[model samples]
Target: MRATEHWPVVVIGGGQAGLAMSHELKERAVSHVIFEKNRIAHSWRTQRWDAFCLVTPNWQCRLPGHHYPGKEPHGFMPKDEIVSYIEDYAKKIDAPVREGVAVKKLSRNGSGYRVETQEGTVTADQVVLAVSAYHKPKIPALANDLSASIKQIHSSEYRNPGQLPEGAVMVVGSGQSGCQIAEDLHLAGRKVHLVVGSAPRCPRVYRGRDAVDWLDDLGQYDLPVDKHPLKDGVRGKANHYLTGRDGGRDIDLRRFALEGMILHGRLLGLEDGRLVFGDDLTKNLDAADAVYNGICTMIDKHIESQGIEAPGQAHYRPVWQPEIGAESFDSVQAGITSIVWATGFTSDWSWVDLPVFENNYPKHERGITPEPGLYVVGLPWLYTWGSGRFVGVGRDAAYIADHVADVSREKTAVPVASRKETRPWHGLDGYNLASAVA
Candidate 1:
């Protein structure tokens, strides 16, 4: 077999973005191969724990022409359901996906890209990096001080409360994951302890509506990350907290905390098999509340400026804000058998050899990177507010495909290997549909 096989494009990471890209390429009659490090929806299968559901509602989860199936399209779906949807998407569109093949290295070869994977090497005129931003977990160093008697797990390893010990549990990080996990454990009849930290809180519901409904009415979903002025200022500062019906009527964290969940100060350290925490639990919670209040203020301003009208302003209760720096955080040394770190994730692209990433982020105009034909998806902020990840990538995928087509038309030569000649099952219609948004 020759070292260089012809393909117009090769996409890395077979997750949502990669699949979407392939669908687009097909429409353009572009010959391409997708290299998935693991099986399709691998992250959904491994990283997310049991009882996990999509934060984005069902209708929003749809990609391009495919809408997530079944009724209640507005409700959240389980992780397994999402994984199945992705697999079905590949099968339905007949996407070219190489399962269990991890791309180890990538480099510029002449005017194209050389992708080295466990299966073999392929040289293509273009490459798309579709790996997600939350590829690695951040485990606190303080967790090491605890003796072997207690279990220590990063949020990535956590599935449900059943994974923890029977006694009191310490949930670190007050972000959405931390809050959700703490709530789950308490509901499972486990004595829970939440180590509070700095974050913005948003009510689970407003009056009789889900928070998502409010976001839709306010055009929050329409805000682009790159173009929006407010997203740039408070991009990753927000956290989800339910206060009313959705927050409490059915499932209440505050009530859970009142009954069994002991709110603790930030987990500072561990000494002699005992946990030591900051004495500022009250202050931290208060600060968290302040962050949330600031977000509501901004949203209100946006609603006014956009001249958007929402239904039932009376039901729109005041956004929940934790009292800043007002209370203290306490720690209990007994019955606490394990510590689950629910802190957020950090990116790991060390395996990706590229000079195009600025401060480890791709330097791209829209979705097109500096490297000719190189693209990235599922980034923290690729284009708009959530451009490269979640339900937002639909627009980003279209933007990239359109740019690729335009660039190709401008080029004189068809590169070393053309997709039309190499791949037998090729079509340009799907690619056109995906890129049509441009």
Candidate 2:
């Protein structure tokens, strides 16, 4: 017979999201445990590239009680620094985290959830799918037709250019990861071909301060996706071409092109001996510029309205580096020996035996699952554009905790004293069960 354990709530995937859920459960005095595939903050430890740093500043990483009290609030935190913070947090909070527990199956039990892992089984009244937003590396199906001789690797597997095969590299997609990898390859003396996409560029700093400051001050970071306009604002919706490279330095694509990167339009598909593209390189570039300008305009207006004399920052007008050429390119003629797919990543729901997906993503409203006792977090645009970011998980975590407390109360008779309890603080972010329970 297999060992069967039970918990009031079981939080899956001990990244920022799962740890956040743990903090919330801890605050509510909820009996919960975190099941991590690896150690705490596993992705930060393994998934990131060698030169990767958070694009956001240090001040934004206000996790549940594990605040960034370091001196460099504005500087971007490196991968190691982030890992250390999370590791320390997991130890300090005493999060009941079971490491190396790979959950093979998560299905519905009688009225709860059954987590079948390599260690054993766990039944929980409530379940949190905080496995993070990105799980599987997204590679286009067209990659199969290309000869295996041309090395291809997703952004997740890529570390440094030295790991790649010799010759010119074609970096598909122009988001932050793609752009950064292209830069890395170019700097390493490898000829790089950057296939620019619809990604917009935002300067790391503006007005002697970070651009994030203006957006955060304007409450843009907290704005819900439903409340936001759809057009010219996709920058906030998807990944943007910006970098925290070299301690939060800006990376402009047009500037990248000026320095010998062979830029191309959106990748259509593989053709006779070349990769096809739509004749939209200039159009896409214009759209990207529009996104950058739109944000600046909003910030400028906010500053003017507040009668604030801000520091002088130079506004930029984009000039096509060597003037973008025709759309299609001969992949073989360009001597592109390798391809880096920085397109994106998606969630893998094979382990999750549930009917909760919509648009190929786990469907939830504010992290609340339609199925009672089920919840999700760490998805982009969950409530705001920052929903999936390091700074945003705490808010969603608190919400999930409240729901868990409510569900737990429903499953059991709540005492009058417990119902009226105001202080639910267990050394986390000081949340009370009474507020959420009511």
Candidate 3:
């Protein structure tokens, strides 16, 4: 524990969420410092493939009071454009972000948080954890069984398939990352195999209008948190499907899969460079349907219990299944030359030493941890109505910042013990229910 003489209202991460926190703090005239592990939006700059674009429309890109100034407001922005937007946003708002300063550990100290970083230690009356989702790439455990001659990489490490050895490549996971990367490889003129794990069949358009337009019109984006808890958990849950916000944007993956892409079952295991999976698609679909219905029913019960009104007539009906159950494929396949696991990510809180999480998940409410003055943003589903993921993170950040500000203003003499400790509140039982439901 290196000690610093002075303290800052510290904000962790320099991604969109962190920037949003800093922006909000500036508006409220709060003095703060943001510690960024790398360059701003470096994940987007480095993680996504070359052809990657925003799944949601540009109109939904606004953060708090700032709207994206562009003619193509409804169009999806590309990776570079998004990076540029964040860069420009930082400049425009003058966020106090210090790049290359990675916080190594954080702990409770007196009335605030003491953050230990590579640069030095800084204390703050409050702390905001804005580290984005997808911090660590998830590679399959069975990958080691494959021959060393075969190449394997998580989507995080993949820049282009052109770097791969000349042969057919197998991409595992059917979520947004997997689909997009598989599409890119296929269009790049390589034989591609996509291993279908789980998928959500999204309507390219809703009732003759773009899906995003419908979402905006229905105020789906404006729906308060606590309405969609399942979505809140996607940032952490492994088997969750990716729901594309981009409507009718034909990517090469969909086209190629329809053409020559060989679809396989979930990647179960590998033997002698051969990947295996169950061969029964129907049975798999049945199991997925049961789980999906269970979640939906649980959510409906929660809504009814809380007296939360359904947003509209377009409110969840039996037909509004956001995900398609994985069709059963109960057999294994051979001849896997290479495997690309685009399965998604997990939290990299290894450097964050705190008692705010149960199994690495923050024990908090809409980003407020049990640890007083410590908060979080950019979780999978922090509150409700799909607020913590990509399209929802900005609003979530705003809400969290509001709560943090509230706590800060009352910073006068309220002993830290007065605040709730979330860890014990959501004990093992609560954690089990949350993990299962999420």
Candidate 4:
């Protein structure tokens, strides 16, 4: 039998969150290993569309010691540049990562933990699951009912308009990806039909400044999840629909409607060779506009209260309105040959056989779980609004590292001879600390 490898700490991801955690662990001289299912920034490299770019500005690319090095701090980084930034950070931090090692299961082993990977089993005193909640692409069960010739795909698999068959495309879900992909297809001169959801919308730029900058200045990003208006409920909210493509601009679905794109209400599954939809097209559009205007109103208040000299702008008006859209339509008759389900994603935590979950979400205060030495990170609103983004993940990682260091110190205080024998604590003063210490 192969001997089980051991580490003081093991991180189970290689994205920005995992990399940031590794950087913090190294800062405290904590010996650890990072097991990556694929290469660093794998999702950014493979999942994103070809024209994808950061919705936030480049300046917010703060990952521990690394910051955006490009000249255009205000501009957005494209897909390739974003991947390069992550790769460079990994190199700069000198993170100890084992690529292509997919962790199969994580279960308790005495007081420590056991990590069974595709390559081998490893034991660690502490494990940090830095994998974000977006583990699996979520598609409605009704998608299985679609005709096979219709050529359906999730947003993650969509590359460009050219990849789809030559026909009008129907994109379901008007979240960030949904709206953006719809625009991408529409810009390519393909007739687009969009199913609008309740997801809100935000202006890319407002009153002569980026909305993100205004929000950052308003200290919105620093607000903790608990202190947020929605509290934990904020995590379930869909991201505001907007785009940074083509120098960044507002994604006005209303404007798109006027420009010949057909808009519908929420997708209500298919029946009798026709797509059914709710009569909430106008409602959804109005809700999105209300949010767009609400943000402008908030920024306006901030400007007035602070007496900042900035440009003034008027509120938006609806460019078009749906006049009782058909509740159902024959997609084949409408020439809709492709369906893009830009429906978001969900995490799969079934492998984690622990009592640390509530309603599929890992129960934790910040990153520390109720189970000692088991933690989670890279989750939206884990601590602050920035907890999962580049602007905030480093701080979250630092906080978790401090706690991990405290746990390490407590273990080190116990005499080596008093502990059970399992795996040697390599490169740490010749301590033969058992991996199964209780």
Candidate rank order under TM-score: 4, 2, 1, 3
lDDT of 3 by residue, 163-197 (tens): 78877888888777887788778768888878765
lDDT of 2 by residue, 1-438 (tens): 156778888888888888877887888899988888888888888887888788888999878888886898888877799999889888878988989988999999989989999888879888898887687899999899887678999988889988887789999988888888898888788899887787777767777678888767766666655555552243234566677767677776777777777778888898875688766777777777776766666666667777888886656688654454556667767787889999898768889888988666776767787776889888776766667886777887886677689778775534323443121212212111111111
- Candidate 4 per-residue lDDT, tens place, 205-261, comes to 999999999878766666666655577888898878898898899999988988899
Q: Candidate 3: what lDDT?
A: 0.64
* Regions of model 1 farther than 4 Å from truth: 228-253, 271-274, 290-332, 411-438
Q: Which is better, 3 or 4, measured by TM-score?
A: 4
Better of 2 and 3 by TM-score: 2
Better of 1 and 4 by TM-score: 4
Tens digit per residue, CA lDDT, model 1, 16-71: 88888877777767777888989999988898778777665676675655667778
* Candidate 1: residue 267 Cα off by (Å): 2.6
Query: Where is model 3 more than 4 Å wrong at Cα?
Result: 1-3, 223-225, 229-258, 271-273, 280-336, 389-391, 411-438
Per-model lDDT: 0.66, 0.76, 0.64, 0.86
| Better by lDDT, candidate 3 or 2 | 2
Pairs of residues clashing in candidate 2: none
Residue 231, model 1, lDDT: 39
